[model samples]
Target: MNATEKFYLPVDGIFDMFTSLTSPSAVTHPVVQSAVAPQQHPKAPSFSKTGMGIIRMVKESWRQPMAHRSSSSSTGRQLSIERQAKRSVDLLELGLAKPKNCHRIVVLGAARVGKTNILQRFLGNDFDESYAPTAEDFHRKLFHIGGDAYQVDLLDAASERNFPAKRRLSILTGDTFLLVFSLDDRESLHHVRDMLDEIAAAKAKLLKLKHPAKVPAVICGNKADLTSPGAVTRSEVTQALGKDVTYFETSAKDGTGLEGAFRALAALGGLPDETSPSRHQLISLLSYQTLCISQRGRGGLRARGHGAPCAAMDPLARRPSFTSDLRLLLKSGSNKNNKPEMCHVQ
Candidate 1:
């Protein structure tokens, strides 16, 4: 038989092709012999032209479904390849562009002002009262929304004013800043004011701009639960930070006001609205991967509630890089090929 010729199975043996029947010789049905050798047996009843046409029709029917399956598989593979190529191109273009979906948020505050606690609340964690001074902490939150991933990098800096260089570098690299002050501490409020000035000065110097650049910042008055006689009033804090600045009174212990503050922060930084703490669901890394895979499947996907799915990476998994930040900031400008000076922390 020619390779291109169709395999014509006997009427009774047609179904066996789908069953345990493998090769043509494996079909032991008597109909197979009758189909092939009508001239050999004189006692056998001869089939009419109509009956023979029906058998050919059945054979063609089986071939059609098999061809359809093969065609469908090829189409699926082509779609998969196109998706991967498009994704790769998008990532490459993103890398070439500055300010990728990931934005760094630097939190600045005086010691014991609940800066870390506020960040903890934003990350969907319980507040801890422990007073261990933080040297520096970095955290990343991944939000999966609209079939894309956006990252928010939170840098919790130490309150020590000794390393002005490190502080200045943080200011220069930060996409947005969160200035926290304790409501019960008047000095903490003063520290926030100083940091604001530092941020403005550092950005102006680094960008070589004559006018102060508009830095995206959110001021938080923490320790709202504490009411001290000498505490800074809301009106006074507003006056000190400037009325134009976005401000919030938050109690990390009570978990109040943090959500709104985070939403405002996300808005100011030009991040997706779903990056807001209240707008996304907290999921484990494993669940995040599973959901991402499901979203990429060919089957139509339905949204899970109104919230976007999110996951948090280990805080210590990635260290902050000044060189990388400087590159990103410089690339964000029109001069893409310019080599910038390294932001020396020491």
Candidate 2:
């Protein structure tokens, strides 16, 4: 054995070799100092006493964003849903700050019939001539009629091609219906009858309102400027429909009857009663017809020799009616009977 190794005490074997991982100063013990390497000692603070500080440093690192810390709690680690909820609340507050008088008007008709054009004209927006099939569109406008303000929500819905259960809600919820058809297109006018029937059927099956015409629906004849001479006369519409229905003539190109149609619709809603007439209890559709027919024939429509009496005179089919702001603006034409047309009744 070497000379240094020969100097061993029996008591040295009492305890096994001792070193420290927690502190550098533990090497001050001569036994530990002799056994440990001096270069291997870390110069920083001892990790045992500084462990909390190291944990705090790790927490601070996570507090700041990876890119760059901007503000107190606006780091990327924030919950995304919490931020979205806050934004939604702010928007709701802004929306509720001021009251809005919103009216939903449904524009329904066949394609290429200017249903979109009338809405755009009312909105003062640009018109697109592209033939894109509409599957329910929405537009908004703020207008004033007779010193009162209103926000009209125009639902430019697709045609009957897509009127499944999902889309029929538009028909049920509309505040007013603008059934648009081109004045130049007589087939569109004929198609309107089918639409009305569909609406009536839908209402009958869905809503049990006092009036069948619960929604203030009006048939709008678009493309007035495109009509030839004597094309879409009020007489023609009345005869085709066989009964009076709310109607309007509009030209989206030159903007004719647009404002009036909207104004009339507002009146029809009976909100701004300033434009609508006073409460006129619905007298009778038959009464209006009898009034017209009796003026021509004396004594409750005099029997014209075994011919069936007028439909108005027949009490079986002739039923109840209600008063509305609905009125027909006839252009003064004679019917097949060579008599003056029926008077405009509201």
Candidate 3:
């Protein structure tokens, strides 16, 4: 017999029986039992009848391959459990990935028209009286609305007349423009026409090259805090620009009309609204306006005209530099050399 069968065999008679059973030529089987000793004489007759029979029955039951079957089943279950754990971790990483298609909105306006103040009011709920000019072309901010994240980049360039071409290109980067004008100054209001012309030119270049859709424009009449009985009216602005254009009278000083203005922008940018059930809701209504006047200023707003004329463009004029008015406002009380934030969200 093999080594395993030899270990199970009894010392004398068991070995002889196993050898005969394993032989291919053997046919007759022998059944035998050991003789009982004198100490076991009383039970010898009972042992021969039942005890030996029970021992043989137990050995026959264990001869089946029960242990080998159990070990194979346990190994298979362990492999399946390990594979499931790996798949769960991979799904979690994918869900945490950053969102794609984040929109960038750039704010453009003349200097000292409260563009930076408007941005600060939206980003941080505070305002500053004294702030410096913006040095970079863009500033970025993030918001979570309607279960989606949006990235807004507000661009306010130096309103000097030196580099018209560079400043024109900066205005082209925005998908939409918030053209800010001062209600207290007629000159600032008149500058909007020139601004629109430059914007249209930049858009035409994009169209010739088969670029994306043209950027939409919105006219904002700022300094509503200074609006008085004799100030320029919204009707006049519409007549000067067109009735088809979007308009808003906002007061950055008193935090008026800020929410509606931003919400309108979010809607125009194809951003989902928290209040809407649809996946993409277009901003259809634009009736939101602020008419509140500031108490700090005089009853009759005085008009402030141009103090410095725009410089002439040079052959070696430097490329236009755009700065975020928000960062400039944020750094008003601290460092002056901090780089303006410009990276896109997605």
Clashing residue pair totals per candidate (backbone < 3 A): 0, 1, 4
Question: What is every candidate's alpha-carbon RMSD to the true fold?
Answer: 14.1, 24.8, 26.7
lDDT of candidate 3 over 186-264, digit per residue (tens): 6777777667766776656544435433347767788888747767787889878778767788888886666667666
- Candidates 1 and 2 compared: the better one by lDDT is 1
Comparison by lDDT, 2 against 3, better one = 2
Candidate 1 at residue 6, lDDT? 62
lDDT of 1 by residue, 279-338 (tens): 777875545544545664634233334235565443333544667755665564434557
TM-score order of candidates, top first: 1, 3, 2
Highest TM-score, which number? 1
Candidate 2, residues 198-306, lDDT tens digits: the string is: 6665555444345554446777888777749846888888887655677778787777777667667766665453222121122233333323334334433222232
Between candidates 1 and 2, name the one with more favorable TM-score.
Answer: 1
lDDT of 2: 0.52
TM-score for each predicted model, relative to the true structure: 0.64, 0.47, 0.48
Candidate no. 2 TM-score: 0.47
Q: List the residue pairs that clash in candidate 2.
A: 282-323
Clashes of 3: 4
